[model samples]
Target: MEWAPVCAEGETYANKCMADAAGAQIEYEGECENYFTKEQAQIAAKKWLEEESPTFKFDGIPGSIKYIGYESYTCFGCFGFTFTFNSSHAGYGNRSGQMLAQAIANHTILVQTRGKNVSYALTDGAFDELRQIFICPAISALIPVCGTDNITYPHPCPAMQAGVKIAYEGECQ
Candidate 1:
């Protein structure tokens, strides 16, 4: 199964003015989600893997998912282009929320159809998937997004904190 939070790579992804700083558009297909923090992105990958696995044969090969971000920065002039996954701009209504994609199907399932000038992403069922995986309460997992956990999805994955084993809260990506 594949999943990704749908996004248009244009028109100032975050709440910036209509002007896209880069004056360039970039869109993504397949499993993807943007997050301000490396921890948040890893959390999302883990969530998606857990949600998608039961439907597929995700065993010794791989189970959960995770990611480590490289360094990125931008002023308001280019923040939108660089930060497409920020909660303030993505589907989440508030900046306090994090951008996450729980897997359902691949890119084919993310969009219903391409519109005249716009394409839409289908993220309505993510909350339901989160409920299914966590089983009790989504946030109840003792794992903190930034700590060292042997339980990371897709074992032997990306190195965290500039090649250090422990991941940090900010600036990894």
Candidate 2:
């Protein structure tokens, strides 16, 4: 007789070892719910970010929000979600977590307002010229820096050369 491992959810595994590795209870065979889809998780992540923003606090500032990207994972008896985001203003970098939606939301709001709080107005034509000059090199170097104007630069040098003071050392987004 050929023996196969049956998990608690009645999912057949290649063998007992495989089932155990998956964290499936061998004795309680039944049905398992479907795993969360990427799109669904993304939506949930966005909603979580929005809902959790009210309580998010950073650097003694309130109502700040950060940008976030979501990814989904499947574990033995549960589904897992993770967020990728930047938190440099309060002083940090690309970070990930299963429960970082609030942090990301706060940081994003901070970055968005980083430029607005300051008063530095530039003409559309001048801004366009500066963008043309520095955007390409910054893109090639892969250095994302934010300017005092709240505009994100491809690199710090570009922002400096353009006479735009560097506000932060990472992408605003």
Candidate 3:
């Protein structure tokens, strides 16, 4: 059965009719953003990673992939997702020993629809306000850090990329 949420109270009903009976205005489709889980985040990232790999040339092998952290933003008919992950393939290359070991980077993907077409993309620079939104640069040192938000960032760069303040030298407590 399809479910609907009374967003104001964070309540979910079996269906829209049940929600309407409760005199609650339907917020939107599916679960609220806070309900999104780490597993779902990894699934979204993996799906897009597969679909965009040909164009993006991602070299990470399947078993070597690990998700560090993610953030999702939703509005009206559009959504944006940002994730930081590591792959044994090492996203950045520097011809040095450690540099060739692993790669940590942030990737942002967006969803938007116009008419009947739905697009999942790295960025939509078409809009003036979104010009600054971009995939973080592919280069990063292997320095992992904890952000003030209590999330572990692969490195300070990705934490900065997400605008999260660095809290310390290692994983969050």
Q: State each model's C-alpha RMSD to the native.
A: 19.5, 15.6, 13.7
lDDT of each: 0.27, 0.40, 0.46
* Candidate 2 Cα deviation (angstroms), residue 94: 24
Which of the numbered candidates is closest to the native, going by highest lDDT?
3
TM-scores, one per candidate: 0.18, 0.24, 0.31
Q: Write the per-residue lDDT of candidate 1 for residues 1-173, one digit (tens) a residue.
A: 22333233422244222123445343433222332243443343334333442222222123222222222223111110111111112221111233334433321112111211111222222321222221123333333333244323221113221122434442223
Candidate 3 lDDT: 0.46
Better of 1 and 3 by TM-score: 3
Screening candidate 2 with a backbone cut-off below 3 angstroms (N, C-alpha, C), the clashing residue pairs are 64-106, 65-105, 65-108, 65-109, 66-105, 66-108, 66-109
What does candidate 1 score on TM?
0.18
- Cα lDDT of model 2 by residue, 1-173, tens digit: 33564444436665666677788666433333332344544444444434432222122133333334332223332322232333323322222331233432222221111111211111111221112232223245667898988999887767755666677889875
Q: Order the candidate numbers by TM-score, best to worst.
A: 3, 2, 1
Clashes of each: 3, 7, 3
lDDT score, candidate 3, position 144: 74
Q: Model 3 clash tally?
A: 3
Question: Model 3 clash pairs?
Answer: 90-102, 90-103, 91-103
